[model samples]
Target: MTKEIFDDIFGKGNSNWQKVSFLRRCFFNDNGITVNWRANTPLIKLWKQAKDLDEFKVLLKKDKDAQKLQFTHEWLKTADKDYDQYLASIIKETATMQYDVWSDAGSVKVGNAQFSFLISHNNGDGHAIAAVFKNEKDFISSPMKFITSVEGTFNIYDYDCGQNVIVTLNGRYDVYVYCGITCFVKK
Candidate 1:
């Protein structure tokens, strides 16, 4: 299911594993239609006054046109060129969407300590949470309760690591973290 959607959004061109992993992460949500990514720094504000997604989209389009837009997709196009821009772009773009399920692919340096994750549940119906953090040391936190779904579609989770940490998913699902700056693969 996810593999097909991945092919659709990003065609079968060059097969870069990191690129493939990152793009696959974008469509991990339940509906498998949206991509949500969080910027390293905050970007343009979605008109808070707007009541719904439709209204938000309208305001977003307006805000973008007014040149009120900030560094939205620049990270995708030119994220620290010294590193893997291809992998970086897809991760950044995926983090900006609103969805029930989504994940990201990334890597950390040898001395790096932790990786942050943004998790969210858009649906109102209560669903028991199930998340796993896998690496040299693995941990799983499951059945976390979300009594009520709120306005903000995401929350932060950090995995403290000894060596290096890699990618993060936006849910309590099992994922992989690895060493090096470009070595996150979801299993």
Candidate 2:
């Protein structure tokens, strides 16, 4: 029994005895409690939200581990307050090229802060991570990779950017693209 029930029946003097007998009670005295003990509480919510078992498993796995990705084509999608765009110039530049690097990214911005994530498939891909700053040089056509954790999320900090400036993800050596999402909050 739980401590609450045990205490009510035998009084507080039985507390130590309850602890001493916990293993035996768990093993043979209570079948219902034993069965529920190993149950995962989050799985119930996951099952409710999921369309099927396969989708449920996918959601569980995404939570349990980071996924790997590969990029073979390059494109850019960007957004600010007034407009969002697919940069045609970058799309044209990467059209004739092929990128074969293992890469992954998923970023979300909240309020004035943006959380970034990226991962290189391996070290052989000839690229380095750099932050996409507000003011970039003339020949720098894309945002370079920035520092990230091993699992790919960036270390949280105040990101520097201008209100009207455009920031986009780019690979140093090859073509790559990822899904971009934006959410807004009222000041």
Candidate 3:
């Protein structure tokens, strides 16, 4: 009877029966039979292999270059909605930037100010910078440029400098200021 239900749900032989395991034992009583079975499908197998959500996230990040697998309609019917939503959000955030050439690393918002971080690669080297914006047409501070390196490692930190917001970029090379530069603001 359990096999019949499994076959009906998984379309008979679609899943590996040898790998399928039971989560609970079948009990018989006047109330009839109760069996708890877990199907070790590729999706379920991946979920079980992860120790926790953070580990799952790391796995997803590492798998970004590989082909993505999604839940089937049948699985979605019984899958955890919270887990599904969490996966969707992770995919959305990670999909926002590409790593090869240029990317928007991320942004931080402090009160009414916003700091945007960007990374650009050129001639086999990469540089990262932070741009501060006050409203849409003004600049609170000059763009802060970090060190350049072949690895393109960069990070941004925000702090309050007197009454103004200061964004600092940490990278591989020595820091220098490029002031009095012609800047263009795109609407």
Candidate 2 ranges beyond 4 A from true positions: 1-40, 57-121, 128-187
TM-score of each: 0.17, 0.17, 0.20
Tens-digit lDDT string for candidate 2 (89-160): 332232332222221223221122354333332232232222232222211222222232222222321222
What do the candidate models score in CA lDDT, each in turn?
Answer: 0.28, 0.28, 0.29
State residue 186's C-alpha deviation in candidate 3, in Å: 20
Least accurate 10 contiguous residues by lDDT in model 1: 177-186
Winning candidate number (lDDT): 3
| Predicted candidate 3 versus true structure: per-residue lDDT over 35-127, tens digit per residue | 323654443444456675455444543453211332221233234344434433333343322111122322221232233332221112222
Cα lDDT tens digits, model 1, 136-171, are 122211111222221212232222222223323432
* Candidate 3 weakest ten by summed lDDT: 23-32
| Candidate 2 backbone collisions, by pair | 74-176, 129-145, 130-145, 130-146
Q: How does model 2 score by TM-score?
A: 0.17
